[model samples]
Target: MAEVNYKQDMPPKGGYAPIVFQNIPVKKYFNGYTMFAGFAAITSFSFYMYYQNFKRRRLLKIERQDAINALEPILLAERDRSYLKQLRRNVEEEAELMKNVPGWEVGTYYGEPIYKTVPKEKLLDPILEEYYAHTSEKAYDDKANEFLWR
Candidate 1:
């Protein structure tokens, strides 16, 4: 083996350049004005959408209310007709039930008035059992059985 001489490498005069240990800050893509503008645009768009939804809901509610108002008189008239029909049926039933009894008026007991506070006394709705008292037992049972099956 031949003898060889090698020179050792030395650092620069300022010692060595400082190592980049910390992260370097990058340039901002959006400035303050741009950020504010984006926020304002998004906020305005959201507000506009909210306002449109609210207006649509309000219009729908008004339309529903108008429909209900328009049908109110017809519904009331139907309810009144049904009430009168039921009243008449109740009167007929009372008359039929009291036909055999002596001194038993439909609205009075032993010729005495049942109600004196009002000029015309309102008949009470009959109970379910009492209303169907005269009906055949088989018919009532059949109706109940049919309802249960359905």
Candidate 2:
């Protein structure tokens, strides 16, 4: 086989540059600007993909951290207020809310208006007196029984 001289035979103006390959004795990847353009395209594509992936991961991490920060304070408050008094307040408020529900009114067991049923100390001149006038002890019981009968 005759040894071909590539560089001397090919001119830069004709757009053919020879490449010396590692495995093959004499070969060219591509003879012109086509090869350069193809490599540029692949490199740009890889870089764009890597950048977009990084941006997405950064945004997701920021959102997760924000959610954790928001929830942490609320959890800490609840943990700190776990005392019996707070628990009772919560239960009482919930009970009041339940009473406000329309359906709960049907099951109400209160006999009479407590203020009206209980005896009051009426005087000609209303002065705070130290003495105790016995309100009928069974006033509450009487009111409750009357309501039950109804």
Question: For candidate 1, lDDT tens digit of each residue in 38-133?
Answer: 999999999999999999999999999999999999999998897667557766888998899999877677678766774545656656565555
lDDT of 1 at 42: 100
Residue 32, candidate 1: alpha-carbon lDDT: 96
Stretch of 10 with least lDDT, candidate 1 = 126-135
Whose lDDT is greatest here?
1
Model 2 per-residue lDDT at 129: 22
User: In model 1, which runs have C-alpha deviations exceeding 4 angstroms?
Assistant: 1-34, 120-150
Q: 2-60, model 2: which lDDT tens digit per residue?
A: 99877555556867767766675667678679888999999999999999999999999
RMSD of 1: 13.4
RMSD (Cα, Å) for all candidates, in order, is 13.4, 25.4
Model 2 TM-score, 2 decimals: 0.32
**Candidate 1, clashing residue pairs?**
none
Model 2, runs deviating above 4 Å: 1-24, 78-150
